[model samples]
Target: MPKSSLVAALSALALTGCSHADDGGPAAIAARAPLQWRSMATPHDRDRLRDWRKAWKTALPRARAFAPERTAAEGALFNADLALPGATPPIGEYRCRTFKLGAAGPAMLDFIAYPWFRCRVTDEGEALGFYKVSGSQRPVGLILRDSPTRAVFLGTLVLGDEQAALQYGADPNRDMAGFIKRVGDRRWRLALPYPHYESLLDVIELVPADSARETP
Candidate 1:
């Protein structure tokens, strides 16, 4: 074979081997994406939240009866002094926004005109148990599972209080959950499938409340 052809063949082989090592298969990439929100807040290219926000608003009133209910048992689960970052919302008020792990994302999600939850903590340690589900002021349960480094919060049911943390855990296989990776960090994602099942969207973002002019 010609020297040039031989060299080209070697290069192609090297490239193939490299790609196989980091194949970046679709499922593998998507799997790591959920954890990516811990450091960055990337939104999907289409920003489906814009479209879904409208749908959430349209269905808010009607979604009440179908809303998940928060129970007394859930509140006692993580009530202990568990060390988790941003376990409590934050000192400054923040509004929850949709979060993702891809291109065209927001550093601080917009708290303006979305199913966002606006909240704040105090100087003393006040942990955030749960926030309202999208659309309505009612909370869709947050079950806590604490680890040495992170706290796993599963959104299970609905809380009646408009401005309180969800302090419990219930359904597991039938709930959507998120992890707070940072210690005392409030920036996390909540993959909520509220109003109904089959809506496993990850567009939620948690940004400071006074950070912007957009208020509910």
Candidate 2:
């Protein structure tokens, strides 16, 4: 599948709602994540990623052990962008950023009013999808990162933000449990935190495509 299609397929399996907003601006923040900003993963990051892989392998036997959802819309509200039948909201575009090279100070948890790392909160036909828009020059992998549940959608938004944050160890912290939320019309947020890398949580705010501003 095409890269964008891959993102859609993976997220659709778990996604399902929100407000209407204008189309967000172009990916102006994309420039910040220039090629020079990229870097290799740290040693600790490699170890943790290995662990995550091991865990996934261990869980493979039970990947299909859970019962199907009782209703099509049971977990449809994984986020506001998820379409709840007729009440679904439009997906928004986000600008992403990461703190890979080094933080100006100790990592702080604060609202990023500017575009650093952004992802699109996709509204699938009956599901929703999301993925990176900038940063790492890699095709991000999407996986359900939370405990098994029929009504929840959780995954990492990696290789993208900074289009780099903790960049948290490895790929979007497949273990960094997080989800989507509606903040306003044509606006949403994906509150994903890197597993164990608390200082680098991703509260990616999304603005509607219509809200996209011309690059200055």
Candidate 3:
């Protein structure tokens, strides 16, 4: 799909946390754990929390980046092309945004808003529900699913909103489940998910929350 349209679709999808699935079982579970929270403390028995701001800032350039620079018409056409079969909601447009991480380079972030639909059957031979991304294909998203559910903000590893983080210490969308403690300006440490402390660094490249705002 055209880059422009992808952004719009993503934005819409982000606004609405929908998914395309034949079974509502997952959805039910997700709803139950919609938003959970935890805390990160030092001297964990297994995991060691290290600051990743420097490494993330260093890898910015290598990461691909994109920004919004087209008209709504262009975005519309792009979305149409991406709206393929099995595509939920059929995303139509999006706004591209970019976040620069010093020497690391720039990371592309899109704001999309759309619908989700899915179809599935239950064990009792009952037709399950249908879920799909509102404006695009299935709702393939990266969410932090700790005891609670925390939606990861698009193009950023940080929680989509403060409420998500405050409610659920770290983001559940990420592979590693742990607490995120800010050490410096835009810098944070992964306080959980033993053996994968470095993996958190990878997410930092995807979402540069450090630069979003200045920390005391």
Better of 2 and 3 by TM-score: 2
Per-residue CA lDDT of candidate 2, range 1-216, in tens?
A: 233443333332222211333233112222223211012223443344435334333322222132123111222212323422222234556554331111113553222223345555464332344556665522233322222221123334344334322222234334344344444445444443334443333334445555663222
Evaluate model 3: give its TM-score. Answer: 0.21
11-94, model 3: which lDDT tens digit per residue?
Answer: 332223355543534323333333221222212211322333333433332322222442132222222112222211112221
Superior by lDDT: candidate 1 or candidate 3: 1
Candidate 1: what lDDT?
0.34
**What lDDT score goes with residue 35 in model 1?**
27
lDDT of 1 by residue, 1-216 (tens): 222222222122223323344464432333342322212111221133224444434333222223223212122211222234444344455566442212122332211124456543233111233444344443333223344445444333443444433222223332344444332233443433222232323324455665552322
Overall local distance difference test of candidate 3: 0.24
- Tell how far residue 171 is off in model 3, in angstroms: 20
TM-score of 2: 0.37
Q: After superposition, how far is residue 94 of candidate 2 from its true place, in Å?
A: 4.7
Instruction: Order the candidate numbers by TM-score, best to worst.
Output: 2, 1, 3
- Candidates in order, TM-scores: namely 0.34, 0.37, 0.21
**lDDT at 48 for candidate 1?**
30
Question: What TM-score would candidate 1 get against the native?
Answer: 0.34
